[model samples]
Target: MSQKTDGDIKVPSKVVVAGFISTFIEWYDFLVYGTVAALVFSQLFFPKLDAFAGTLAALSTFTVGFIARPLGGIVFGHFGDKIGRKKTLIVTLLMMAVATTGIGLLPTYDQIGIWAPIMLVVFRFFQGVSVGGEWGGVALLLMEKAAPSKRGFIGSWAQIGGYLGPLVGAGVLAVVTTFTTPQEFLAWGWRIPFLISILLFILGLWVRLVMGESHVFEKSKKAPVPIASLFRYDTKNVLGIMAVHGAQSLTLYIVIVFFAGFLKTGASFTAAQSTLSVVAYLIGATAASMFGGWLSDYTGRFKVVGAGLVLSILIAFPLFAAAATGNIYLVMLVTFTAGVACGLIYGPEPAYFGELFPTQYRYTGVSVGVQFGTLAAGSTAPIVGTFLLQWAGGGTWAVAAYLIGWQIIGLLGLMALGETRGKALEERPGA
Candidate 1:
């Protein structure tokens, strides 16, 4: 292959496909758990608790994966920055496949007594670790390979996995639940989604194995200790990334994780209807991610992300109100719009974050920073929303207020970072 400078290098189509497929598999493994937790985990693993407490417990296990992410980020980021992005990404994919498929094979409370939930949390933690490492590698792999002007658009393909994973997860669950009786669904149907991870893992592994390492990483000065250098040199940028990403993660779990349960109980919707609503949100997110990434290529990352945060904040109260109305059409419509807002924030994010740090420690900086933000926001969103609903006497106003508050923080985060729309990957920020 002919070599070009980093500023103008054209990424191979296979590289993009590898990044997209690997990312999709990583997220699908992680997120399929959330969908199952919402629908069946409480009943299967935490059977002793009452409905509310059981749901809370199940969601808590979901958070376990997030808690493990930073550690995953720290460990994998170090190696990815030091060795290469390609190898670490392959490890993460295999880790997620094992954890997810393990969950599928696990016996529930009825079959194994107390060991069920204990083993469940163990598997979920591994899933968390896998995902924690997965995003940064793929994001950098795409961002560092693309020409400067096309970075945003190419990077968004990684973000598409974020939305599409959950979309396909919920869609698969919807299909399974539709075909199976309620009793059968609660018994075995949920496991199908988790088991399917094995197939996805094979596809992801093949593509990623064939793809080459990032040329930027190949040429950049390697950090002696990437994480330490990241803290010493780019702490502020890390915090800014956290803030910029917080609101989108918060809103995502609320819709994808919390809303399914809320609709089932609070709005009196069937499980199928609730699952379908998540599919709607994903559809909008998948489309808007492409648009936002393309727009950021022209308008700059701050403009595109800031507009998204503002729109999401404005829609917060309306979204909850529509959910309360018990009208599926209105709920789906508002949810789709909310997805659009969040997508815009997400689409430009990989390139923006990748641009913030020097290539020497870019992997560590992006992985740790984004994982911390996600752990703080996305990890707690469903559990926090559950408590807010109970505290508000089942009213959704408090939840809306909660969402708006985070969006404002995200706007502030956008203000804190410099625009990096067309910045060259090889150029250090200060030097």
Candidate 2:
């Protein structure tokens, strides 16, 4: 490893690849549940309710994972700050793998009655905690190792994994659905994706185990209580990160989780079509994230992210209207555009948030800010969107309005914070 006197460092390509793979595995474990929840959980786990209520119930359980995330952030962030990013990331990956595999093994409502859903929520909570800690650690592991000029681009490899996870998850589900009869799919196919986690876990563990800790973290003075120090010294940045992330979460999850169901129930699309739309969104998101990250290196994080939020707001109504058209290609086009817009916000996020706090508490600060933001918006987006759809007699206008509101809040949050495109990680703002 090479470090300049100005605190910039050169990270090896192998380390970046390892970080990306581990991040992909962790996110795949967490996001596979969302795909299942959208598709079959209502039928399998909440069989007793009417269709509308059942969908709501299934999505509520999905929200449980998000609800547990902040706790994961606080706990894992504590250890990550005190111990090291590499160790904490390994622990989180193990937890996620176990929890995800556990979900695969659980019996449905037909077999276990109420115990099935209860156990599902329990496993989901652990998965949430695992991922809550996973993002900040992997992000720091990459961002902290990269040269200051390349932090945004390198940090985006982690985000790319995040975007790719859903694509791969949805792809797996689409494949299983294609091979199995509807009866078989409902009976056994859904578990295949979850069960595959064990294998991915092995790969991620091997990669992460060989990777080194963040040099930037190793050089920093440790805070006795990183969370407390974070709140006391950088509360404004914390809140700003939350707002920025909250907007992106609300926008993205609405499309990822809510839109799939909307296409099925409202637009009368087939299951495969709904899944395909999500795939398109993920593809566009993944590509745009890479572009956004590279662009942020030159244009500044604030400008790119702010532009994305504004673009999201401008496209809010058009996105839903296109979905309402019931043409799969059109739906894919609009959703892909929405994904690209959201990607701009996500791509710069790791570097942007990591730059806000000193290394002493960066893990805690980033984890708490991002998780809390996700908890507030991403957690309830599907449920809230569903309720709004019902309240509006299945019209998507209300959902569009909801998205616009969050994007505006995100823009305001962007304005509240200073640009951090080229800031050195080791420099504390008020020190």
Candidate 3:
């Protein structure tokens, strides 16, 4: 169902828009929670605890969402394989919307006793599950429809949503907090951002409704087997994909999502300043991500990913040190650099990882790869970074050293693998 636009490139606008909008909604729900966890959730949800302990509690609740990602992947992957990608994704979208909007309505410590944080944990875990289910289908839907040469560029659209998700969340939160008195903001104004997710989800749903099922997945439906066969037969490929995904997750959640909080709490920036800087960083990252995907088409995924890892190692300490010095310009420069590095890794990942498994096993393979990272590196980095900051007397060195170490791990993982550039989807059996 390709439509001819002015460029006359045969393209499915509805599918592309659906894929983009759906991912935007999913990540919007996920990122807002992360932004709040880093800044306000610790104060709101864990109000009774001391600052450090409260931060830890908030992070732990956030990680609970990560902990559920694998299960979501498994469940959604199973149905995506058996029933279809479109319907399975629709269900995840609904779940995410409900859980996210519910988080806005929950009572605090004064009204609900222990149920406040308890309900937050439950809603967050559901959000995690929904996101885990969401990414695999969104990637599959887009990559399946795109031309081989253009798949990298197309797939990177999802990464754009990832960056934009935080921007929207931080931007809205920043605007709301700016106008409100601190007392009013801390009381109920913060809930406005979470409540607004209902509108985002509804808009995304409207877009997704107009789209059709992916031709690739539809073609594969002729003789589909259970998704379980993927793990049972291709365990080695699964493990390899997991490693790469771990690298993406750790770099993303640890550095990008939590960096604002780190700057605000540890580096002594005001919340407004931190949010604005993060929005700027994300904007740069979004632009770099699209460019990185285009570069991968020419340069290859392995090289681009490997280069990003090396850059991470080299600049980790320098970037943090610059930010620690309280130079506003220096902070923006380093943060923007970090965002670009994340873009380099994230941009190429959808196609790279999708190519690691066969069409029949693609959903399970990508989901497992991603969620494994979420469970291991992605969820733990923020908490670990916080502890490292404390241990290092709030110095930037420890946080930088920790991030660099993980990047080195990802570099080694990428270097050990063979390049998969220029291989046709059908020619590459695993893919």
Taking the tens digit of each residue's C-alpha lDDT, what string does model 2 give over 103-159? 999999999999988998899889888888888888888888878888888888988
Q: How do all the candidates rank in terms of lDDT, highest first? A: 1, 2, 3
List candidate 3 segments past 4 Å from native.
1-9, 35-56, 109-114, 221-227, 257-259, 264-272, 392-395, 427-431
Of 1 and 2, which scores higher on lDDT?
A: 1
Question: Would you list the C-alpha lDDT of every candidate in the order shown?
Answer: 0.85, 0.84, 0.74
Model 2 reaches what TM-score against the true structure?
0.91
lDDT by residue for model 1 (1-431), tens: 22236643678887788777766776676667766796789999999999999998997898788899999999999999999999998899889888888999999999999999999999989988888898999989998888888888999999888777766776677688789998998999889988877887888888888888888888877878888888888888989889878888888888877886788888899977887788788888889998998899899998999988998888888887887788898988988888899899999988999988888889988999889989889888877999999999988999989999998888877788879876766535442
> In terms of lDDT, which candidate is stronger, 2 or 3?
2
Estimate the TM-score of every prediction: 0.91, 0.91, 0.88
Let me know the TM-score candidate 1 reaches against the reference structure.
Answer: 0.91
Clashing pairs in 3: 357-430, 358-430
lDDT of 3 by residue, 311-417 (tens): 66776777677667887678777777777877888887777777666666678778887888668787787778888878988776787777877787677667655
